[model samples]
Target: MNGGDPPFAQRIAQVSESHTTRIFTRAQQMRARGRDIISLAVGEPDFDTPAPILHATARALADGRTRYGPVAGEPGLRERLAAGFEGFSADRILVTNGAKQALFSLFQVLCDSGDEVILPRPCWVSFTEQIQLAGARPVLVDTDAGFQLDPDRIAKAVTPRTRAILINSPNNPTGAVYGADALAAVAAIAAEQRVWLIADEAYHVFTYGDRPHVPVLGLSPAPDGVITVRSFSKQFNMTGFRIGYVAAAPSVIQALTRLQSHTTGNVCTFAQYGALAALEMDPALIDRRRVALRRRRDLALGLARALFTCAGAQGAFYIFADVSAHLRAGQSSADLALRLLDAAGVAVVPGEAFHGPGHIRISYGCDSATLGRAFARIKEGIKEGL
Candidate 1:
């Protein structure tokens, strides 16, 4: 090997590591050194996996479900997932390790060299990197001041190379939920442009207030080119279970299944059983969590608004606040994030990670008391000119 040469594939150079995970790891390291750290970096639910899921997974293991399974998914689980959407059948669903993997596989199967996928900014941290990993380019369109999608901007950004338009509702960092009209417009653009529409609804069930989540597939005469990706992690507290599925046309599902067959075969067999149990969980349980999170969102937003200009977080448990006011001269949001971690004992993902600079994403997924204390420290840190 030549001195100072890069060892990994050249494609690795096109992407960056997830800043959310990096901040999370740094927080863990700080905690290991006995420093008090409150992390609002990763978007994991603070609750445990519901008991019924645990019991079902145990039973599945006891029944010897440890062996290989169908590449598409466990038949029963696929059927149940498909049943959630009108006019969809099991053949249209492809369960994968998580929504992340489903998206990765989708990009791989759909993209070619120089293809482009249009998405609004600031989006989740992984979307851009995932697009680059697939040898496609990520075309980022700016949302309005309220972080709502502008279909006209998306339409303007489209070109011959555009292969897909990816959207997230009850979005990750900004928590902007797209209403049906806006979603339909984007879908129409995709249809007219002959491009695919991929909707990442991982936080679909997490919306609050009157902003009910509108499933992209639930549109009247649902768009045929649409792909919906959902996860069990956020809603059911199944992050470790790594169970998520993609619902699309049967042809798309077949292509993903062919790709997954050469990749991880099936999602963990027993985990799918647990996911099956999650589908049967009490609706009230999820409602209770949503209610609690709404309270936390209010508390966190109140605190954050006092510190910085904030986005209108209509859904999801995040407050994407502009911390540029708190930053020192020449300091980026990343620098401010690190300073907050080292000085304030609070960890937040910097805005640059999500293509939204001069801001930071604060997750309200922690307990109420912890969240209160973390914001208290952050307020003090800003007062001290951090």
Candidate 2:
């Protein structure tokens, strides 16, 4: 070892860089270089935060709401979150910096070395990485054609060392929403196996078609060991604010709260007030965003289906398209993504990062004009074999 080098944790060295963030960084560099890059890589809405929420934050600032507060978040926000969770009590909710932090804390508190956490493939890239950070191995089960979680596959993956299963409905990369029947089946397997079921419902507010977002806690004969994670980032376009919450059994909530207290303390005071106002304000604001997202999703899916093989994008703001048809015989997803960026100036994330190689995730959160330009560039690139 070099004398000048400080020793770092073995775990930190082993952790992989986030694929999504890496691509985002490249896009930023391209923009700096004056490239006409139409970035469809990151999952973020292009719209400004709702006006009412903005106004509320201003009011909070005027009222001197800036100070260190409860480690579990402001009481008013927790109360509103508790009410939102059907019949759950306020004590069961613990707010954190974001759903990402809440998830990291949950894994830290629950997972131990050599334990296994089951995650469905084509998942959010962070899922596997976070479990690894907690010293737990991620057991990935491949989904069916539309990226729907197959309960039978989950059952097969479970072993005596399995500690928990992480499920993300209205999922990140695939935008696949598990049906009620599928969720119920998963709950049954978790109960029979006696493993924790952690559900990520970040995109609960954005859905298309007639199906509603079903929280696993609401399942009949509810799975006794269920934990739900919710976020204000997607719902209220509060991504920069980094505010989210976890709802679970009081025991699990306490463990997560303690872990967060030592790690991030509480989220920013002003952000907490902003989220509270989002919940208390007119529901119509959220409804409008939902409708707009649905329109964008439909358009993107239409384009994807005409150009590539894609499905399971009935929710969220992303479309995971199978680009194997476009890839040359020996080419990989990373190769194809770079080529697309260079030749077409369109930025997309390779599905390889999400354990779904031969595909790429495209976000439709941008305005119609930007999406149109991106698709056109992609179309030309594919035609020219670029």
Q: All candidates' TM-scores?
A: 0.98, 0.97
Each candidate: RMSD:
1.3, 1.3
Q: Residue 272 in candidate 1 has what lDDT? A: 94
Give candidate 2 regions above 4 Å deviation: 1-4, 220-224
For residues 1-386, what per-residue lDDT tens digits would candidate 1 score against the true structure? 56986588989877788999899999999999999899988798698889999999999999999999999999999999999998889999999999999999999999999999999999999999999999999999999998988999999999999999999998879988888888888888888888999999999999888588998776624466899999999999999999999999999999999999999998999999999999998899999999999998999999899889997588988889998877778989999999999999999999999999999999999999999899999989888877
User: In lDDT terms, which candidate is top?
Assistant: 1
Instruction: State the displacement of the C-alpha of residue 186, model 2, in Å, after optimal TM-score superposition.
Output: 0.5
Q: Write the per-residue lDDT of candidate 2 for residues 1-386, one digit (tens) a residue.
A: 57888889998887889888888899889889999898999889998998878888888888998888898889988888989777677898999889999899889998999899999988998888899899999999998997888999999999999999989999889989888998888998888888999999999878887467787877735544999999999888899999989998889988987888888888898888889989987898778888898888888888888889998888898999999999898998878998988899999999988999999999999988888889999999998989
What does the lDDT come to for candidate 2? Answer: 0.88
